[model samples]
Target chain A: MTPGRKLLGHIALLVPPFGWLGIFYLGSLSVLLLSAFWQVDAMSGEIVRDWTWENFRILFSDTTYTVIARRTTGIALLVTVTDIILAWPLAWVIARKVGPRLKLTLLVLVALPLWSSMLARIYAWRLILGHDGVLNWGLRLVGLPDQNVAFTNIALWIVFSYLWLPFMLMPMVAALERIPASLLDAAGDQGATPWQVFRTVVFPLAIPGMAAGSVFTFAVTQGDYVAPMLVGGAGSEFIGNVVYSNVGVSGNVPFAAAFSLVLLAMVAAYMLLARRFGAFDAQ
Target chain B: MGPNVLMWNTKDITTAPTSWSIIYDKAYAGVITVPDNPIQIADAALYLSHTKPELGITDPYELTQPQMDAVVTLLKEQRALVKKYWALASDEVDLFKSGDAHVGAAWPYQANTLRAAGVPVQDIIPSEGATGWADSWMISTHAQHPNCAYLWINHVMTPKVQAQQALSFGETPANTKACAEMDALQPGSCKQYHADASPAYFSSIKFWKTPVRQCGNGQNTCLDYSAWQRAWQQVKQ
Candidate 1:
């Protein structure tokens, strides 16, 4: 086919997806951005056009800014680190040692939890992490402190880590699988320890995949409201809670909008930094 | 001559406006706005208890653990079809405007907005009647639009407007004549809304003094708010 016709084919294929993205995601975000500048009448619930920087001022000055930012950033970093540690071994096992059929089966097992609703999974975690929940009940049988043991920050971190594990594992497995067996044999032949071989050969190759996984874990957990609401205590209240209460409790949509924009900026800066550091190298 | 009307303990109903009250009219389901501030609950409870006890609600003064449990159970059962458990008066206004709620336990100002939005909303004073807060329509010390604002106040308080507002907004009109006019609209149904200016309605609906374990009085030890919070959490769990 001529280059022109080929371009036409590609354009036709891209149109529907492009239209969907433009109308829904981009359009909604534009409106949300507008809402950030608008002020809400305290009594009337009316959106007044008194364009003021008061909303942004609150975002910086209020206690909500510190509490929400600290919790969101803390949880995001923790989930990212935990995912990396847990994913590396599982990815190595799946990519190198397993039979093709067994590998596929194990992959299915890892990915299966993703099929469940995010809300249902959170509720299930709550059951396991409640004060009188399954974990405490199990611990009580073993003669542990049954009260105030579960339902802490530790419980929330565990749930968040569990939720995002597959995101980390899948990418690492894909990256590791792409590495030829000859590369490992070459390292082994040079009298390098398994640790050294891993450091030089495996680690560098997997950095890009690890970075992608980090983005998912960091972004999602940073913005997650429901997990903290369902599982975490007062200390676990994140930016999501601030955003929610601003809109619902205080009826201060402009401040909430400003807060969300700041969050978006933070995530954007993180991604930009990751890219600058060569986090992605598409093969 | 119209029966005398006395306003009692409640939040600044002016904050909510009067247009968001239709939710209560549809379901006849008892409503509860939560994080359960005792005074707010008490006002609604006392109002309901005296004027419309057939709803099987207890007085705020008499509210105890068992009563709370019953209320919770009732709320849970009606969760599927409640106008809503309104957190903000704005939310209540949205519910009224969208017709999601027919009779709401809402702020008066919210009900006013809904009426402006053409929803035929009313804050009904139930036969066992309504409870709302003290929000005087006064000229602010820093008044900008003084005459217009005063006109706005007088217009709202006018007898015909008050009657229409009582029927439409679901609140007890301050004007006794308006309340009477509302009573005449559906005769027997209006009695509960008058509430007899009961002492229970007035004194009982004070700001919820969260019980402190070591209250200054040294007579009786009150359970702390933390205990109540823990208990509430356990119940949810």
Candidate 2:
């Protein structure tokens, strides 16, 4: 085969994927971003093509979006931190300590829930957290009082953490598995304790993986409205919920589009910060 | 259609509430739930229309800036009493069944469903009356089958069909004769839902309408739906 033929083969493979991304992903996004600058007829509920900054003005001046945005970002940050603490040990055990067969079993266990619909899983959490739910049933059996945490921000946090744990675990497992066994052996030969070897060597190598996992946990939670809808209480409204009501309930496409741009900017800013921590390199 | 109502767990609440004021009472704080909807602002406005006549709020759907301010103030205070703002009728059902909410602003559909599930819930139109909605059917100007549309509307309004429709949706029919059909379908349903409601009973319900800047009194003083939507956001906050 000639070098030019090889280059032609590469182009053939690249064109299809590039075309898909260009037309579907970037195309729709551009349309959404364009709608942000438009306005709607309040009475008729029709889209007015004339460009205006009124939507953005209301978004900024209203203070409601600011509060919702902060609530969403804060919750996303907490969910990320919770997943990191939860997934780190499990990922390390699967990658370093377990046999290959057990490793596969553990990985399957971590990922088993993802095969089911996300909606189903969130609804299942409701059954567990409801007033007469499994949690209270267990408490009663153990001679303890029933507790009410259902439909609260605390319930939203638990559900978000559970939903994104697999995303965090899978990436950290890959990063941990990639660490060479020779590095550990070398550190031991130098008379380093097991704890010291782990602290200095294993931890540093895993930072990129943690950053990669945090990207999924944080960004996904930031844009999620379903969990908040199913479990969140009064005053637990997310930015996504506000955007949703604008689109689905209020039929204010322009305002929904404008608010979505805020979400995009937030996620894009997060990506840049994650990139600085080497999230891209791990992936 | 039935009015928006106050549904309470008869077991938990012991005493039946006679007014919308129970929702704002600090005594029931953390045991109440309401719709997570902007339209709920109308429920507040309806409450104030009678209690604070000085605000001059005649229609829940039509409001000036100051009327909205008063309604939102009431909503903000009621927020403290709410355990959660339910997004769906099913959500309220689950809340009542699990003892998460003792009383809430709900629809008749929720009460019927909860009672069927043995939740011991009852609903009512409080002393200030309640907000409701009417469904209208319109024929398209350029429709290919306009005659078929008319036939469909006529069939839907028939006494027997209206009774069936009312039974299915837990709502009342506008046709006066449908009350007799309701009794034929189920002996006590006509009385149960007040299908044969008097003129005075009908007058109390403030049906929903599009909130426009143009007021009924030939003024542009009333705020639009967009303003209501924004005010609702602030109320929840």
Count the clashes in each prediction: 37, 0
Give residue B173's lDDT in candidate 2 (0 to 100): 84
lDDT of 1: 0.61
* lDDT per residue (tens digit) for residues B82-171 in model 2: 889988888999899888899999888899999888999999999999888777778999999999999999998899998998888788
Candidate 2 chain A worst ten-residue window by lDDT: A274-283
Point out where model 2 deviates above 4 Å: A1-12, B140-142
* Model 1: lDDT of residue A203: 94
lDDT of 1 at A138: 90
Off by over 4 Å in 1: A1-12, A147-149, A277-280, B1-202, B207-237
Q: What share of the true interface contacts does candidate 2 keep?
A: 0.72
What is the per-residue lDDT of model 2 for residues A25-126, given as tens digits with 9 covering 90 to 100?
Answer: 999999999999998898788999998999999989988789899999999999999999999889999999989999999999988999999999999999
Work out the TM-score per prediction.
0.57, 0.96
Taken in order, the candidates have interface RMSDs of 15.2, 1.2
Q: Which stretch of 10 consecutive residues in model 1 chain B shows the poorest summed lDDT?
A: B1-10
User: Could you give me the TM-score of model 2 versus the true structure?
Assistant: 0.96
